[model samples]
Target: MHIRRRRAVGRHDASDYGLRGAEDGAGADHPDLADRRHQADHPPGVAQVAPWLKAYFTPAEHHSPEMKEALRLSDELVAKLIANDHVVIATPIYNYHLPAVLRAWIDHIVRKGLTLGFDGKGLLHGKTSTVLMASGGIYTDGSPIRDRDIATQYLRLILKVMGINDVTIIAAGGAKGVDLSRVTREAFLERLDSEIELAGA
Candidate 1:
């Protein structure tokens, strides 16, 4: 099984965060936008068979319990997601890891008895979750800063509990190469487009 990673690029606006692609034409190459366009063209998973897709948008009203409930209602979230075509998480990386807001959301969703529970067989399982993470710096497996990949490990463990063995990761940021240019971003977009197609297939 494979895990598909979906990134959240537009989660941050230019005026707020000092990301490179805040301007109008700047983020065209962003992995999130690229996946959006690709999904628009080719929807992933079995839409007809699955049913509804409840996309939980985060980074809004961090103090609200309504937002935190997304995780608490593990059964509800799983039912909504499993019945839907595919799962997509659009999240940007902050400080080399998942943003605090995202982390909070995760805390709510990963309930022990709800999202995941172990059988007498000592196996863990449940719903499928995917993540797409983007950061200003690159951590593509072996860079010095790559040690900051605790987010990936954490996500993987969460999914594992829910019985989701399929996992995919797409990393895009300054770590891949030294020069962060439009060309590089475009290249990343192209790769993202291809991955979307593969996921759809």
Candidate 2:
């Protein structure tokens, strides 16, 4: 449910989201490499599924489509996750909640009878997930207009729907007003370093 200030790419493009291909084709198939197969033999930590992270700081290769097309392509993230790796999402909160792109990605990944299906016991289960969010304001508890980080709550529900109940959040706020002339960007980078270390542990 955390919102990262940075945008995420769903193995489609590095940046820029625009849903252009709505009526183009619906059943066209992606490559076999694009398919997410559960490989139990692989060790944990050897695999992971953070679409944006894979392309972090890299040059944008292409632009994502708009609307439903963008959501459809975001399924690549789920494909990467099928290998049974812990997930860490970096995103931003917009309009007091997660960005539409993030929601779009959620729609792509949370599949029925795939990510979550009733077992013989009628229970559900899936992978683990986490989120890192950045915001412009300092309201950790949020305001009347804002739902006090409703993004995090919604993310939990997303994971819950997929039977992935293990989730964590790290929030960064008021980053825009920082005194870059004084402490500089190193300080912020250090915080990210520590966060990555802790998450890796």
Candidate 3:
């Protein structure tokens, strides 16, 4: 099986938290580590499928050139997702939530004709997904700000709307300080490691 890696940030994001594109960098130190580590340990069992990465994140709007392009991009992304057996989203949290770029990207791909039907029934099925989120602050189940995590929650709910019920979320945060950074990164890796094993099983 192949694991698709979905990155939600861009180059300019580097200035902030050094950008999570770097697996070991400060910004989301373990960004997408789940997919990367899983693919490494699992050999060819997993591969990152992302044709829409080139589409990147586009501006949010329903009736504009960007939206039109987003629709096309989303259509392709949906196709890829439909074709894949497994998928994983590697993302970093921004302001107690996922970056706006990811939201915009989702807006394009979760199309009615593609992932859902006119009767509001989900058409996309027969696939499982996991979400790995790296954040600057802790937001676990009992965290004081758990309710503020719009990104992860939205991801779970939205993916459900697409008929993907076997969804799992691995949220790793509390990287705000030098002390918390290493600890947080380790925890993130550990969680991903466990999840990878489970997926392999």
Candidate 4:
């Protein structure tokens, strides 16, 4: 009914996306941590399933395999998106934008004729999504870099263009500087744990 704003963006490493493994494997057996349990819980009698897929970039020259695979993946990815009730995007922000690999993936799945309009309007409204990210510097409430974080804002805009607006974001910032990494990492991890706990609700 009203406008919604997003949280700050952070710098990230290529390895941070391993969180998706946890998302995909959420229903699997794991230790009894509250968050883990929360993650694994599902509606009564409803089965849980995790289907994994990958996308890669093809240069302007269109490397044969990469381009072919990306095109194919795009169709499947967009279809999966259309069918999904919830979507989770686990990524690291790169130089204030999306990671190159993730960006390419977005480009592939967000097709003009299929997922969204050519004028950047979205068709998939009413779906919900969550994004988990880590940054090299603190861009959250405690820091001064809040205004500089643009990655989440960009992502939210893109999703809106595709008509997906019910979104949530978890950003772990301040993981870069030598003197602040530990504090920032702790803060972000704590939030991550909290999110997992809330997953069951």
Candidate 5:
């Protein structure tokens, strides 16, 4: 199966952490994953979503020249989703939720008659997804702030809406230690290696 990885981080950071681990575990050299055609190296531009929303709500505008141009990137993003069998989303939590760029990418992909159906059904079926999230605080079981794990919760709901019900979430919590110099990035990532490998497998 072809795997497409969408990451909401800079190229350097994306390669430095969980995304790279997942890629390696999934066999980066494998033919299906080797072709980077469907991978989104960086998050989409957040500013462009405004025009996309306008065109999305106005069905008549979909065929218009201006609207077509506005929706080009969104279409491409959705096309990638449709093409891949497995989707891996690597993102860092921002304020207990998705980063602005990742949210914009989500907005562009949840298109009616494309990824979603006109009858309130999802068009993207038989696809699976994995979300690799790095957060500053622990939000898993036993964590007092578990309810604030909105990023993971939101992603699960949205993926289900898009017809990807079989989803795996790898939560790499307490990542702020790397930023604070309390732990090296490599060491922090090592702790979640098994989880990342399992998800990729």
Candidate 6:
């Protein structure tokens, strides 16, 4: 099983961490599971989906040279999503939602003819997904601010639309403590070690 690890921020490559097969419970030691990382880099003007949409809607015969160029990255991203059995989206929440780059990545992958059908059916099936989200505040069950967990809900809905029903979300809430130096990063992560291991397995 091949898994695509998408890090919303390009600062780090997820492949370096060997976090493959987390969705299917195939532990990292699974011999057949391989990790393929795709960093969603924040290149200048790369997150604009309008140009790609314009090119995609234009008739192929009447497409300009620039149209093809506009579709290049979107096509590549969609193709990669289709090729993988499992997809891991590691992102940080921004203002109670997804970062611009991650949202752009979703826009690029949710293609009409490829990932989504014209009839509103999802083309990509039999796939699983894992969402690793770090948030500044706690919003899990029992939290008063749980209703503010828009990012998780949005991702689940989108993935379901793309025919990926089996999804696991590992929420690392209260991450601000790390930034504030109230809790060590290692200690915070250690608290979630079992959850992370189970998700990976």
* Candidate 1 RMSD computed on C-alpha atoms after optimal superposition onto the true structure: 11.6
lDDT per residue as tens, model 6, 1-201? 223243211111222122222343543444433233334343223445577668888877788889988988777767767877777776678789987666766777787888888898888788877777778899999999999999999999998888889988888788888778898867866776776667556
Local lDDT at 43 for model 2: 19
Reference-based TM-score of each model: 0.52, 0.53, 0.61, 0.61, 0.78, 0.77
Q: Per-residue lDDT for 31-132 in model 4, tens only?
A: 221121131321121011111122232233544664554355455656767766555565666676776555655655566656787676787877776666
Better of 1 and 2 by lDDT: 2
RMSD of each: 11.6, 15.1, 10.3, 11.5, 4.9, 5.9
| TM-score top scorer | 5
Clashing pairs in 4: 10-135, 11-135, 11-136, 122-161, 122-162, 122-163, 136-176, 137-174, 138-174
By lDDT, who's the top model here? 5
Clashes of 6: 1
Error of 3 at 23 (Å): 5.3
How many residue pairs clash in all the candidates, one count each?
17, 13, 3, 9, 0, 1
Kindly report which residue pairs in candidate 3 clash with one another. 3-47, 4-49, 137-174
Total backbone clashes of candidate 1, pairs 3 or more residues apart or in separate chains: 17
Model 3 earns a TM-score of 0.61
What would you estimate as the lDDT of candidate 4?
0.52
Question: Would you list the rank order by lDDT, best first?
Answer: 5, 6, 3, 4, 2, 1
Model 1 misses residue 140 by how many Å?
Answer: 1.5
Write model 3 residue lDDT over 67-86, tens digit each, in one string. Answer: 45534645555665666645
Give the residue spans of candidate 6 off by over 4 A.
1-40, 43-50
Residue-level lDDT of model 1, residues 1-201, one tens digit each, is: 122333321122211222233344443554343222221322223222212122233333442564444333434534444343334454566665665545543443454344545351212333334455666676776788777777678767666665566766655555233244545555655555655456534
Off by over 4 Å in 3: 1-71, 178-192
Candidate 5 wrong stretches, greater than 4 Å: 1-51, 60-62
Candidate 2 stretches with Cα past 4 Å from truth are 1-77, 118-126, 141-147, 179-183
Alpha-carbon lDDT, every model = 0.45, 0.46, 0.54, 0.52, 0.68, 0.67
